[model samples]
Target chain A: MHRKLIESFGIRVRQCREKRGWSQERLAEYSGLDRSYVGEIERGRVIASIVTVQKLAQALNIDLADLLTNCGPPSGPGRSN
Target chain B: MHRKLIESFGIRVRQCREKRGWSQERLAEYSGLDRSYVGEIERGRVIASIVTVQKLAQALNIDLADLLTNCGPPSGPGRSN
Candidate 1:
């Protein structure tokens, strides 16, 4: 479940960034994160800290709740709100 | 801004736990995290990783978005969804 959630989150991040026409490097610059780290996050190879997530949200100009809730299709019944 | 956000997150966690009549130790147990760590999170002395936040959300029986959004009174105008 955790792995699935992380993967979904990565996909969400990628979609959001792409929606803004921002490159991984551009997002890294805006979020004060490493480009490679952002790539890894988008690939679901890494899980970010809450601070990092907040930075990404701020850079994307989205609310934190929106980032988490609208990441993908609704999660499974037992796993979601 | 980061500090304030963390503090608000902590307060939200505390309120959620209390509403369930669960002790810090119990929340820690359910989340598979350490009691002291939970305390630190509640005190806003630590910033948790996304995975940890998810664990806390699951333990609290709340959605991740709700945990992040409903933690405190609405954030300032510049903040919040």
Candidate 2:
């Protein structure tokens, strides 16, 4: 898997899950993923499939776009639109 | 490919690329992706690899997180952290 994106995604999964006051076990159940797999995502040990990502996004009620872009902040923070 | 995410990504790639004043060919070159593939992304025809997503994020000087989140705004749009 691409290391940076994987790692970035891990951090996000953890941050979002924790923000929701859910433990790994709860999140795993809520996201319909394995607990160990959730841990893997949190640890940056795996790059999730699109279905998995959608499950996670759905479980969290967040747009999939939020998961991809919020690592730190944009360097060029200007709106091109 | 997860159809929704891929299609969502296509729209985003198109919106962002145009916002940057980049042509499909220019974005393809800038992102180190093929022009046809860039078009695929713009048109939501395929899902990109992590490497491809990274390249596009880099070329846009935007955070990967931004790409994932900015889909029509979050329902609640609150900060967890």
Candidate 3:
């Protein structure tokens, strides 16, 4: 489940960056993150910190909710909610 | 901005746990986190990892978007979005 959430976040980050025609390097520049780190994030190789997530959202100029769509646990049966 | 984001997340976590009538120890047990760590997170003294955030959301039985409400930068005139 954690892996899925991380991958979903990475995919969302990649999608948002691609939508703006920004390369990984460009995103790193905008987010003040390392280019390698951005690549790792997009590849789901690292569990990003909340601060890093916020930086990516700001750099993509998107809402945090928008970036986190479908990144939560599925609303299925047997759930406590 | 990073400090603000972390603080906002911490506040949300505390609010959700309180709404459920759960103690920090209970929340920690549910999230498989340390009680002291949960306390620090609620106090905005630590920047939680993405995995930790997901665990908290799941344990709270809330959507990640809901947990992150109002966590993004405000849509002000100077914003790029």
Candidate 4:
């Protein structure tokens, strides 16, 4: 469940970045995070802190709520939203 | 800016917990986190990881997006939304 949660968040980050036509490197640059770190996040290799989440939201020009949408454990018993 | 951001998140956590009339210890128990850790999060002394945030939101019975509302840096210029 934890793994799924992290992976979903990474997917969300990638989706938002791609929507903006920005590369991972571009996101790193805009968010003042390391390129490797951004890559790790997108790959779901790291558990990002709230501060990191805020930086990503700011760089992506999205609200924190929007950035976090659909990024947690499966909502319902049989399936997730 | 980072300090303010963490502080706001802490404030939000405190508000939610209080609204539910749950003590910090109860929040920790429900979230499966250490009591001290929950206290730290509520005091703005730590930058909680995504997992921690998820746990808290689940324990509070709130959506992640709703839990994060008003938890980041203020919006707009000179004034925050």
Tell me the tens digit of each residue's lDDT in model 3 across A1-81. 899988888997888777666789888988899999999988999999988988877776666666778333222332111
Stretches off by above 4 angstroms in model 2 are A19-21, A49-54, A63-81, B49-51, B69-81
* Top candidate, metric TM-score: 1
lDDT of 4 by residue, B1-81 (tens): 778878888899898887666788888888899999999998999998889889888777776767777433222232111
**Shift in Å, residue A4, candidate 3:** 0.8
Query: How many residue pairs clash in all the candidates, one count each?
Result: 0, 12, 0, 0
Is 1 or 4 the stronger prediction by DockQ? 4
TM-score, predicted candidate 1 vs. hidden true structure: 0.84
Worst 10 residues of 3 chain B by lDDT: B72-81
Q: Please give the range of 10 consecutive residues that has the lowest summed lDDT in model 4 chain B.
A: B72-81
DockQ of the candidate models in sequence = 0.54, 0.23, 0.59, 0.61
**Residue pairs clashing, model 4:** none
Q: Estimate the TM-score for candidate 3.
A: 0.84
lDDT of 3 by residue, B5-77 (tens): 8898899888878766679988898889999999999999999988898888777766677777832322233
Runs of candidate 3 with Cα error greater than 4 angstroms are A70-81, B70-81
Q: Candidates' TM-scores? A: 0.84, 0.62, 0.84, 0.83
Lowest summed lDDT window (length 10), candidate 3 chain A: A72-81
Q: Give the range of the ten consecutive residues with the poorest summed lDDT in model 1 chain A.
A: A72-81
* Predicted structure 2, TM vs. truth: 0.62
Worst 10 residues of 4 chain A by lDDT: A72-81
lDDT of 4 at A52: 92
Query: Of the candidates shown, which would achieve the greatest DockQ relative to the real structure?
Result: 4
TM-score of chain B of each: 0.85, 0.79, 0.82, 0.82
